[model samples]
Target: MARNSYTIGIVLIGVAIILLLGKLGVIHFIASFFWPLVLLIPGLLFHMLFFNRTLPSGVLVPGGILTTYALMFFYCNLFGWGAMSYLWPGFILGVAIGLYELHLFDRNTHRGVWIAAMILGAISVVFFVITLLFKLGVYVIALVLVLAGAALIFRRPRSW
Candidate 1:
């Protein structure tokens, strides 16, 4: 019961903070620039306070919540409703760190493996796009190299 109440209180506080910012048009102003980076300080503090020495599930839920917030902010920016342009990179970085932490729990886990894999996969996709646009043979080589790197990383032991 106490835990439930605490959880509800935290949720309410978060909502209240957002509402206060919205009501004051602070979010609108902050979104007008790269001020969203200011979120990193509290985010880091929260991680240090609650996530240190925690299990994967503990980190995952909060990480997901933060990622969702980031996405919504990004969407608002993309739609011209906000001003921040570098939101997605922060979101990606947060998710990458969370995934890496989660991977720390299990020796056989491949969760963090997707972080690198996704980057390489994106490179391949970009190369494919370039190949379509310019008929570039070099992009094919780039794609192959990216895939090889991903494959090697995936196949390597997670013991390190």
Candidate 2:
């Protein structure tokens, strides 16, 4: 009976601590900031397994992908989700990174994998450029116009 009472008391204390932490927002804080670790841990495990020879190089594909995505998520979480509009290209880059890793680490990798990785990487770059231009293009255009106007005003031939 004494052992049972002690166990019950310990369990109640543990529950109370958990509840207090949750109420204090500590649990939410950890969950929000460190949730990317859920993806990162498995990704790292895959890499470690490959390095240890417990898994084949094929695992690197998902490993690279997950790690990249986890990093991207962490960035968004730290900054803001709005940044994802510009960072969406990172998704394509993640696959490209995975394929590149496979090409680099796999002994039996083919030329096709390298080509695919390059194509995807190029696509990601293109998307990033387009997104940036779409988002900040107006500011750039405004600056250019202002500069052109200043140059015209300062020019010697002010007749026109």
Candidate 3:
């Protein structure tokens, strides 16, 4: 099939580049960095297959989650494992994204699906922000507390 050949050609090109890079001695230390692409390629391929009508649409959820998780792993791989502390919310967000994609593209989507996606996505965003602030250190919390106290102390009494 044309699609299969196209995928294979792209894969061959990728391998060729990696080999070239390896021969140049630039890939030895960074070979592990490419491992996540293994996940990303198949994940993206599933979505593409769905679009190309070669696979059932049900694969979208797995595809989206895999793609999101692969990116998350890639981020951690590049930034260090400590990045996972604040990036943990990506797990929930990935599922929420898949749900959103399903609800948006599926004609028979249920109202509950949208509601679930909104809830999960909002929680993930909030958690990520809070965790990131925490990782940024105690200064942010102290500043918030100081601002709140100042606001409270400066409040004027309401006229009766």
Candidate whose TM-score is highest: 2
Inter-residue clash pairs, candidate 2: none
Model 1 TM-score, 2 decimals: 0.29
lDDT of 2 by residue, 27-119 (tens): 999999999999999989999999999999999989999999999999999999999999999999999999999999886999999999999
Question: Candidate 2: where are CA atoms >4 Å away?
Answer: 1-7, 142-160
Candidate 3 stretches greater than 4 Å from native: 1-30, 142-160
lDDT of each: 0.58, 0.95, 0.88
What's the count of clashing pairs in each model shown? 1, 0, 0
What lDDT score is found at residue 2 in candidate 2?
Answer: 100
Encode model 1's per-residue lDDT on 1-160: one tens digit a residue: 9999999999999999999999999988876755444444445455565556544334543554464455556566557653233233344445555555445543466654556636744654555455454554678779999999999999999998
Candidate that beats the other on TM-score, 1 or 3, i.e. the better one: 3
Q: After superposition on all CA atoms, what RMSD does each candidate show versus the true structure?
A: 16.0, 3.5, 8.0
